[model samples]
Target: MPPIRYRVQANGPLRGTAVIQGAKNAALPMIGAALLASSGQTVLRNVPTITDVANAVELARAVGAHVEHHPADRLLIIDASTVTSPLLPGDLTRRFRGSVLFLSSLLYRCGEVIYEGAGGCNLGTRGLDWHYRGLVRLGARIEEKAGTIHITLGATAAADLYLDTPSHTGTENLMIAAATTPGRTVIENAALEPEVVDVARFLTAMGAHIDGAGTGRITVEGVDQLHATDYTVMPDRIDAGVLCMAAGITGGTVQLVGGDVLDAFGVARHKLEQMGVTLRPEGAVTTASRLGDLHPINIITDTHPGFATDLQPPLMALATQASGTSYIRERIHDARYALASELTKLGASIVIEGERATVIGATELRGDTVTAHDLRTGVSLILAGLVAHGETVIENGRMIERGHADLVARLRALGAHISREELPDTTRP
Candidate 1:
């Protein structure tokens, strides 16, 4: 597939509904964990059609899972019972950092495995120090080669694991490895994101003992064998919020169907309210209302219960439409401000002060050529393109398709001007 660019033009304010997709973050790791089950096969429904999902599926197949994907049904099935150790391709693993999660599952099943350096969105140095640190504490002998990190599981039980940064994937790597070990393992300062809880629930369904998944601490009691069972993935709350921003910014009302509104999106609603976006209670189909005048507000990205760092880039795009200056402080990924540069092309004035950003609203934006730095940044740029005057061409559109399925078609359905065009890689020249 060649590189893609989005040609976007806005309608007289966006006026329609946009439904959310499955949680990309949750489904990727959950599908990866399917490798730990030896008795039955795991089926994942409502998985997103994104690059990360593709990466996870490829990793599963490489690790010896009988993988099958049904795009129409949005389902993925994996039978890892006959799993084999195929020396997970280093080139493949470097595509997405989530591949690091496989280290634990593979170590538990095969006792010895070789892995390459983790890769994902280039958001600065996302070192695997915490992951390796946690694994070493779990009695795993580790060595680093040219680019692969080989892991060997020692004959041992569980131990207490403390995360220095509450890394979600790191906690998951250790949790999955500890599930098959004998004895108790406690993970302190564990990530409390809903996706983290989903990972814990999947492990519990596979016979692993776990408690306090959606909290700061998680305790796991190792089980002998994990049997597979059917499980449903949680809704994509971040997707819901991003789409909601699309609706609100366009002066349109949209209903996010089939989602846990209060649990997953209550904080987003509260944040939007500060910017003058209102949510009307309607049970399962919640409606979003926005005033023509959007005021700037202060936002701090943190772990779950606070504004999610994943939605920060898209939300920053929304902030561009606000009336006053908005402050956005990103605690997770500092380099996330790359979108600010693109937004600036659309007449947005954003000042970067360390990890925080101050954004001044632009009354009317004139579209121009912009580059997408990563997945979320790509989609956020697309959103900006929808509201910009004239044509907005988004470079690096493949990143958007990685997380969002039929994104251009979906926006078109909502009456936005959008189309995907292939662009050549000029760097070769």
Candidate 2:
């Protein structure tokens, strides 16, 4: 088939609830970590039915693990007891970037893993040097010969490893790698992303000793073994943030359901409040509504307890509707503003210069055809369409489906006029 497209027609505010899916970022690494358990079945609840998760399940099966994915019930049961492979499926691994997360688990289980290919979103150069160096510090022998990552597990567990940039995946890799080793593993400069903390909790529930999850420093005491555990992935905080922005930009009132009452998106909630958005976090759900007009708010993406880089796209879409110019400084990835020009197609006043972009708001956005380059930008385009004056068709919509499940249907349930359409495969013979 051709690239899937989303045709969204919007004329007013959205209503109803958005059921938050499990964090894709957290689930992928967690799926990889399942292999660390030598026996029993690992049950992951609230699993998001997205392409990335499906790819992860395929990766698990390719490695000789039995994975039963129940999208109807949002559950993934992984049986790694029968794992017999040390090589990640190159085709599958090359298709999804998170596949690299399996390296540590394979090293923990099989003592060696050879992966020749790794791919994901084109977020410029997210250096894997931090991961390689951190793993090496943890006593793993890592070598790249002929473009394949060859990791040989050290006989002894890593004592202390420090991440140079507090990379989210790197931190999780070290934590999972250290889980079964027989020593106390200390990770300084650990990523404080909420998903990282959730994965740490999941490992902890699986009998690994971990502490300082939400802080920059983490300690993981290795145990003799890890058993299968039933755990639920945390709600996708970025998804929750997108909905919150959806409400804010469209003058809509939406209650983001099944979240941790805005705890994970604490920084985003504050940022939205600064933009005159009314967000109330009570109990399990966080309700986001309008507080008159949106005001300008400048933000910079930083490590957790700070604004999230993933939220930048949708929030950038939100800024286009704010009353004044809202400045955003992206310190995470350089090429993330690929969506900025697409936003300009919708009549957004956005001037991007390198890592800094000035989004002048209170400008009326007229819907136009746009392309989504990545998962976050695809959803961001959808949010922009929800408030645009006319029909907005987003091409490359498969990018969004990679991370979000039933997004159009969910948004439709909220009274947002949107539908999915399959583009004719023009490249087929």
Candidate 3:
């Protein structure tokens, strides 16, 4: 197979209903938690069919666990009872940073593991100091040997630990570390993302006592053992936002089937409403469109309950249609402003000053070939293509497919004229 690129033309509007898949961020950690089950078959329902999930299955299988993925059914089965390794596969582990979450299970089960540098989106310097330092505080011994960090779990029972940054994986790794450790552990300043809550629920279903998952503080009570059971992953809020932005860019109405409007989007839902985007609430489903001219609004990205940085890319695409200047402050990430450069190729007038970006919109955008630097950036370019004039081609969609499920198929279902084709890789390693 060759490298994939999406060719999109302005086909009028994106008007239809599409069901969003399970959250990738949520599924990754929950898959890790499945390894904590001492016995029995751990079944996960509504798992997203993406490359990252497939790689995670390989990661699990590499550790000696029996893993099965049923993409047609969107389910995953893991039998970690047979897991017999402590070294995580470096090749697959480096593909995505969430691979670090697997360490919690190895430490809790095997009591020791060796790992090296983690990898993920090219956002500058996502420090694991919060994860590593937090784990060490909970009685785990850490040794740095020949560029690899060797972690040996000496004791599990602990009182409380606090994350200075509320890292999502930090909360999860700690939760799994405490799950079978024989005592209650309290975590302060925990990540408030919905994915973090879902992982906590999965652990609770496996007989771990957990409280305050969606809040800033969380408590986990260790159990003597964990048994495999059936679990469901949460819906992808980022995908729902992308669909909504897709509709907004094309000036059409699209109903996001199975979108958790309130829980997932949080502050973003209200911001879309404030921007003259018509949002009709219908239980877990909502329809979005922009009949009137969109108004620009100020947005600041932060942790959960605030405007998410993950949504910033698509929202930036949406801002191009707004009638006035849109002020966006990217406080959470340093290099996320990279998209402004790519969007500029399509006639978007954007200027990045430090962590802030000013999008001068209502600009006439024409399609051209663009590059995708990361997952959200790829989605952002596709969103721009939906409304662009003439033809737009996005190169190197590997990262996009890694995060989203059936992106081109889902968009085509909504009446958009988009086709994905594979082209030979022109660059050499």
- C-alpha RMSD between model 2 and the true structure: 1.3
lDDT of 2 by residue, 135-169 (tens): 77778898888888898887675577778788899
Give the count of colliding residue pairs in each prediction.
4, 0, 0
Positional deviation of residue 249's Cα in model 3 after best superposition, in angstroms: 1.0
Task: Kindly state the number of residue pairs that clash in model 2.
Answer: 0
Residues 158-177 of candidate 1 have per-residue lDDT tens digits of 88989888777877777787
Query: TM-score of predicted model 2?
Result: 0.97
By lDDT, rank the candidates, best first.
Answer: 2, 3, 1
Error of 3 at 20 (Å): 0.6
Against the true structure, whose lDDT is highest? 2
Candidate-wise lDDT, in order: 0.81, 0.88, 0.86
Instruction: Tell me the spans in candidate 2 whose CA falls farther than 4 Å from its real position.
Output: none
State model 3's lDDT.
0.86
TM value for model 1: 0.96
